[model samples]
Target chain A: SQQGEEDPQALSIQEGENATMNCSYKTSINNLQWYRQNSGRGLVHLILIRSNEREKHSGRLRVTLDTSKKSSSLLITASRAADTASYFCATLLRDATNKLIFGTGTLLAVQP
Target chain B: SAVISQKPSRDICQRGTSLTIQCQVDSQVTMMFWYRQQPGQSLTLIATANQGSEATYESGFVIDKFPISRPNLTFSTLTVSNMSPEDSSIYLCSVGAGKTEAFFGQGTRLTVV
Candidate 1:
């Protein structure tokens, strides 16, 4: 079953600006991960924030996790047109099986 | 990270026919998974492929309709049988090598006529 629900289903922003997306899940998770997918393509792993980590960063991407609220947020700094894509947040539940439940996703369009 | 190669990248098939998409991974993994993404919708897990055993299918997915084959640790295949127009979507194969991160292949874009 789908657990994560992303807000701001679609967003448009100018280049050099920052974009933020939020996600909420129903169940507890081992980790929350963000991914990027260009049109008609595969997903690229962006960043992963463990349950123990409140926040983490990689390059210009920052991710924050709130296990108590079962929510997470992704912030992209200095967004570029190339960053335009559908971003999805996936959760790995505490179960032993490595199944990932994906969110509805947020479509971000970076205007040049 | 493990590299996955999936094919045929895209295909157009008739309603009564079947299409088997293959996924080959560079490194061995304990489990491989199949997911389907409908038009403008999020992906749904179809099944989990485990080596040397029958695949565990998810709810709303059946073994008769979506058969999965995991021959080894690094390879698997998913067959969409007797497909209909509704089956037209992106089929992705994924594997988790470390922690909770998964690696995906360029998905198979299937269009059932």
Candidate 2:
């Protein structure tokens, strides 16, 4: 069973607009990581936020984790057409084995 | 970060046949995992391939259907035995070092007919 659920299964916006995706999980996690996948390729790691951290930033990507709410969000600032892809959130549960539980994912389209 | 590679990028196989997918990492990794992604669905973990030991499968997956082998720290193989059309999906291999996030390989796209 999947532990996380991402909201707004699909989203569309202009190239310069910011795109936000939210994910909610049901279990306590050691870390939550985001990934991007192109049409038929493998996934690329975007960012990871530990349970103890509230927010993190990498380049134009920002991720926030609220342990109290058991949720997280990913914000892509100043998005580009190249940023159009499927985004997924994977959780590594505390004291669990090394496997990650992935969410359903969100498909984002950025029109140029 | 680790660079992982999978063999037979894509294949079309006949039903009742078997196919083995290989995964290789550029550097040594402590843990290797297999996942399946059906069309328009999320990825699901299949099993954990531990070096020189029996693989640990998830609740819905079993060793008889998706047998995994890890002969060393950087290489693992997953064989889909007695495959059927329903087994067609993308198989991905992921590697994780201690305290690091998992890194994925270019998944193997399998099509059973």
Candidate 3:
């Protein structure tokens, strides 16, 4: 089962603008990672924020995690037409095994 | 990070037929998993295939419906049986090693009619 819910289930933005998506989970986690899927196929990993970390950045992608609220957010700055894709947040639970539970995605459409 | 090679990227199959998707990793991995993603939906894990052991299935998933095989640490296969329109989805294979997060492969896009 999916453990997180991401909203603004759909969003539209002009190229060069910023796109922000929020994700919330219901359980404790060891780490939170964000991924981008193109055309519903292979997923490209963007960034991973450990439980102890509050925020992380990779180029234009910024991810923040709030353990107290069990929530996280991804901020993509200067979005491009190529950046248009379904973004998902996946969680690595605090359990002993290494299973990743995914969240309902946010579809971001960047108009060129 | 280990690299994965998955084949049969996309297929259109008839109802009641089955399709087997293969994933081969460049390096040995301890845990390999299978996931299903419906159009415009999140991914749901189906099972964990551990080398030298029987695959462990998650709730709402069973071996008869989605059988998995892990012949070695670097190779695994997932078979979607008795395909239906409802089974049309992207099936992904993932691998995890050490302390890193699980990495995914280019999913197999299945379409059943």
TM-score of 2: 0.97
Q: How would the docking of model 2 be graded? A: medium
Tell me the tens digit of each residue's lDDT in model 1 across A1-112: 6878998899999999999999999998888999999995899999988989999999999999999999999999999999999999999988987899899999999999
Give candidate 3 regions above 4 Å deviation: none
Best to worst by TM-score, what's the order? 1, 2, 3
Best model number under TM-score: 1
TM-score of each: 0.98, 0.97, 0.97
Model 2 Cα lDDT, one tens digit per residue, A1-112: 7988998899999999999999999998889999999995799888999999999999999999999999999999999999999999999988658769999899999999
Interface RMSD of the predictions, in order shown? 1.6, 1.6, 1.7
List runs of model 2 lying over 4 Å from the truth: none
DockQ of each: 0.67, 0.68, 0.64
* DockQ value for model 2: 0.68
* Local accuracy by lDDT, each model: 0.93, 0.92, 0.91
Instruction: Give the TM-score of chain A, superposed on the true chain A, for all candidates in the order listed.
Output: 0.98, 0.98, 0.98
Ranking by lDDT: 1, 2, 3
| Per-residue alpha-carbon lDDT of candidate 1 for residues B21-77, written as tens digits (9 for 90 to 100) | 999999999999999999988878999999999999999999999999998999999
